[model samples]
Target: MFRRQFLGLGAAVLAFGLSLCGTAGADPLPDLKGRTIVAVTENAYFPLNFTDPKTGEGIGWEYDAMNEIARRLDAKVEWKTSSWDAMIQAVQAGQFDIGMDGISITDERKKQVDFSDPYMVSEQFMLVRANENRFTDAKSFAADPKLFVGAQAGTTNYFVSVSDLLGGDDKSPRLRLFETFGASVQALKVGDVDTVLMDKAGAEGNIAASPDRFKIIGNGLGHDEFGFILKKGSDLLAPVDAALAAMKADGTLKALDKKWFYDYRAAH
Candidate 1:
């Protein structure tokens, strides 16, 4: 997620209004003339996007949001999956028309890919095993030399572990790297790592999955916003943004957040 000011629901709602200001016209929604757009995401980001354990099919907030956007625009979406590490580069290479994996709209990433309006505001939190209580927060965790943090490499989670918890030491031996967020969480489960930094939504999803196994402690660590990614100067940018604005105006976005983050619980 792109680092920014801590935004409540009101601020997130205001962000949608601001995005609408960019496209000047009587109609905020656009029709894609039945065109098919290819969209890609890592099907491992819980609540945002992930495989439903019961059906083994991809489904989450992003899936619903993108499908709704396509419907509103009168377009068809072709879903594809890629590793989180390769998603941005693959989209930039023109392999996908759109990408969404709770991608943060950071200035550095903006240089490589165009981003849609902020869809969700999130904050990083400490996810730890429920039974353990060695450290309560970032500061307490940092004080313990035996503590180790699990994080996916080249992600907001990893950077936050390094910058916020580890005093900007990217090479800290206490940090353990994994290929995916799921993997990092797995490490935490098996005692390979003590904690995992995750967005509040994701942390909640995991906690819901195994309430007796995991819990989030401490206040949020960083303020961030999520947006969909497109290739630099992609032709679909305006239409996608317009559809998002319409969704926000009609309460579709808020409803989706409520469904995936607050209501939906995976069967264990």
Candidate 2:
């Protein structure tokens, strides 16, 4: 029920500005001549790219955004799924034309793949079982000897848990690693771990889905900018960026954000 406000223009003002930029009728987008682009994702990150339980089909913000981009660019997309750990490297090896997993844009990651302009900015938040009251924030959670966090290794969540909450000791016993965010969340649900660090948007979605089972505690921990990954030197980079810019300018991106982050309900 608690939605975090962003540090930018409000939705109505942004939409009005976008409409002015696009004029009334003329299409200014580039045509890709029906080239097929391969897109991959983990499909586990809630409200970004994940399987819909009711439909057994992929759906989320990224899916909608990418599809619209392809439409505007006069291209087609072939979607694929990848494990979270292998996504960047796989894209770097030219296995996929692009990858999306709410991946943060960081200097360390830039070495492997080129990133598009950020689609969304987010922050880390603590997710814990609703009945727990042992600690209200990270500091108190760290002070307790019996508390530990569940996270997927090689993720922003894991790194934040290590650096911000566990004294930068990645090998600390207080950190339990899982193969997927779903696994870590399962661990949290069963009391296997005291908490899980998640992006604020995701935490909000999960909490809204299961209010009695989960709750977010403490202030947001860190800022992150999410972008789509492209192989270095890929020809598709510029076109994808252009399409994204158009989407932003036309308010399509803003509409997708509202649909996924604030309006849609996932079947838990």
TM-score for each model: 0.89, 0.90
lDDT tens digits, residues 1-268, model 2? Answer: 1123322344454356346544677467778999999999998998898887767788888988898789778899999999999999999999999999999999999999999999899889999999989999989998897999999999999999998889888989999999999899989989999999999889888888677999989999989999999999988888888888877877778877776776564323
**For model 2, what is the alpha-carbon lDDT of residue 217?**
94
Q: Looking at model 2, which ten-residue stretch has the lowest summed lDDT?
A: 1-10
Stretches off by above 4 angstroms in model 2 are 1-27, 266-268
- List candidate 1 stretches off by more than 4 Å: 1-28, 266-268
Q: Pick the candidate with the highest lDDT.
A: 2
TM-score of 2: 0.90
